[model samples]
Target: MKLGNIEEDSKMSPAFFLQRLPAQRRSALHDVINIRHAYHKLCEICEEVSEFYGFTIFTDMAHNGILVTLVSYFLLVFFIGMIKVDLISCISYGVIIVWFAFQTTVLTSYVTRTIIQIEKTANVINKLIRQCAMNKKVEKELLNFRCELAFQKVKFTAWGVFSLDRSFLASSVYGSVHQRNLIYVKYIFFKILGLAPWKLNLVTKPSKNRTAKTIICKFSYLGLLYNVLLTTSVFLMTSYFCHQHNSVQAQVDSLVTPSTMMNLQYFAVILSSSVFLNYTCRQKDMIGILNEIIKIDKKLQKYAFNSAKNGNIIINLIFLGHLIICSTLICLQYFFLQSFWLAVLRCWPAFLYCWLIVQYTIMLDMMEKRFKFINLNIVKLGEIKVNSEGLEPVSATRISFLRESVLYDVVNIKDNYNKLCDICNDISDFYGLPFLKVMMYHGTSTILILYFMLVAYYESKEFHLLLFIKDVGFVLWMVFQIIILTTFVNKTIDKIAGTTATYLIILIQFRASTPN
Candidate 1:
């Protein structure tokens, strides 16, 4: 195809060139070009409207509403499927499922079609540039149009977080299911450890009434009893072993040795476990603290705190590392002692002690995140420029509204900070004794391990490489745990201090901005 005159073609509509083309080609090109133009115009209108109001005004609410509605329907269908329901009910559920599936399919199909149509428009533009006799001007315009089409392609999003397309449905479902499963896994892990003494009520919304019901489970008492009995057994066995070892050593007139250090370490572990058992007795308080923390997490989800994801992974990895180290030490004990039951009895307290420390450290890390999030908000408030110069004069009412909003935000942040402080106090009260015991155990163990290592290196006649390596490893592990625990605690303290400093800075700025 050939355009007779470039100037004339430019003067007429771009679609005028289609008149010279074949009937079939002309109709298709005309339709594609018209659709592209219409889509472009529609996108511009949507953009302007979105900018005038707000892009994400109802985004979260819409997404949550849809998710809840679909999930509720699916759950209803599932419950009906499980029961011996009447024929009408079964048919109704089947129809509901089918209707939802059909609706989802239709929505995705239409979105896919629109995307395909946009793609086709670009392809048609390319074909016209190559197949038709076009000047540099026409080719440049076509290329520019193609670039615009590519740049401004239509795609729906959920609060600008993720695209809504065929994959969205699958990903949304997968994410929801995975999250539910992960919560259960965490609950099971904590339940096994006696850290979570209460029952997990996944179906019911978390509230005071539900909390009471969940805490009423027999498993909580059983877990607590099991921990108490285990602590007692471990302590008694450790005491018996220490007594027998000391008696033998006294008869031989031996000085402090590796075996002696081991006895001391076992005692330290027993002491830590005993302290932890004391905390485990306050299951109701623990549950309440956890529920409050959950509420804090939910409240802060709108802020930068949401970016601090993969917390579960960190917790799980810490637990896994603890498990590996303890298992290795236990295996070594089994190999050397040649008594499975005795090795387990001797090593169990140490494992429990480390596990308790890990739990305490995890809680500290969570608190630190919340404090950090609050500090970030405070810093952001401090950074807000109070004086807006070389701008349109804002109305008195608008300025008053802005001032009220800022004050409201500050009040809300202050309230959250106060609540966080209360939560921290509760955590401290809950873990205070256990933390002290852990610190004592770590300090004594470290000094003894180091002293023994030094003595073994210089004064000992025979040095067992494996035993020496194990001693070094144990000392390093204890030091590492102590460092991690202290680091989280310090970070939380620092964030709290920073929050105060931020408030003072903002106050100074406000004073400086005010007229005398």
Candidate 2:
């Protein structure tokens, strides 16, 4: 039942493991595919030994982290299922109503705390450990212990910290990305089905003949598609809710006023906006991961192919294109929230969406690692195809190309940092072990506490929140209209692709036409 032995670990290895392993202990380990490429990227600089042998901190976790998160999520869901609506209302009236301000404060504090944890944890572990071993007699155990220490910190830094804390009352960043994609995908096809929007500028910048037509025919369609998808979904949903509220108000007009209907609508919009915005930074991280990976691959080509030395390029691919996408989501939410209070409540569902995404990331990270091992093993055992593509087989042309990529003709680690330093590629400059320990130990637990505070605050004043929503429904309803109109109008190809003069002209004409 207990998997504590190399025998079990060997069982986890791919068929190719027997041939590829330099050390038996490092062979035959469990695989987690989610972010293995990212690990491969990071391990380049993350490795501590003079040997340049890289092992991913995440890939080696046997994927227990994801399992743990899932268990936590299910429990949270179970508790929510037990909550009664009337009880929520009573609590909201008595306690939560009094604490809305405090909840806001807590949310602010939590987001800040999580960011700090990330900043602190992304350290150059290999450099630090080599520093420790420079003068002292290096024991094998010490090496292992030091490596584990640095890894423990990464276990809870940046995204890890974000995932843990952000999941408290709402969902996870992962969930939000999925939702945005789903919502946008559905909307685009149903209403604006033509071509996908060209997100980048190279395609849009005028160059050859008929640039306007090119922009319209080639790229505008994609933007329009996304716009149509989002607009249709938001407007349709808003219209449905507005219709339902109108019908209910007809029956209860004597009891509640139109102003009351508007307030409740506002509250719901707040919830939606919050959910949408959290995905912003997530998109940035995705890009970071990809950039790191590309760099690592280049590094490997330069260092390993020419010489017989085993070079592990430190490319943390997990930080790739996803970051940009997530950041956009965050910005999207921010704009949505700025429009109304109803958008705030949407944070919870967004958080839920995030939690689910984190779960998959963990799973995929595991799977990628396993497959990497299988690839390595296949190459080692000569099981690879004669045309084996990715396995970096040694050849003259490959070695020559690799040499060109390196900063210098030299490839020795002894000279580079004068210590066991790996190239750590990240946006942040500050990273260390103390920061990591703090993150790993505090990241999840801290957010959990904050989430609890949020829940408790809400639970206490359920009635007031209901009343608040009831009072501001129409103002909130305006948010739905805003998202629909702005998304559709701003994204319009002809309008967006217009020259600066066009915008000025439109602005002037509109003002001149006004009754004021």
Report the C-alpha lDDT of model 1 over 112-158, residue by residue, as the tens digit: 66667656867777777766554455555667777887788556544
- What lDDT does the true structure give each of the candidates? 0.64, 0.34
Candidate 2 wrong stretches, greater than 4 Å: 1-62, 79-198, 201-218, 245-256, 259-516
TM-score of each candidate structure, all chains considered together: 0.58, 0.23
The residue-by-residue lDDT of candidate 2 on 148-218, one tens digit each, is: 44555322222232322333323322344433343344334322321123332213345466342111112
In model 2, the number of clashes is 104
Error of 2 at 121 (Å): 22
Q: Which ten residues in a row have the lowest lDDT in candidate 2?
A: 307-316
lDDT of 1: 0.64
Clashes of each: 0, 104
Candidate 2: lDDT of 310?
21
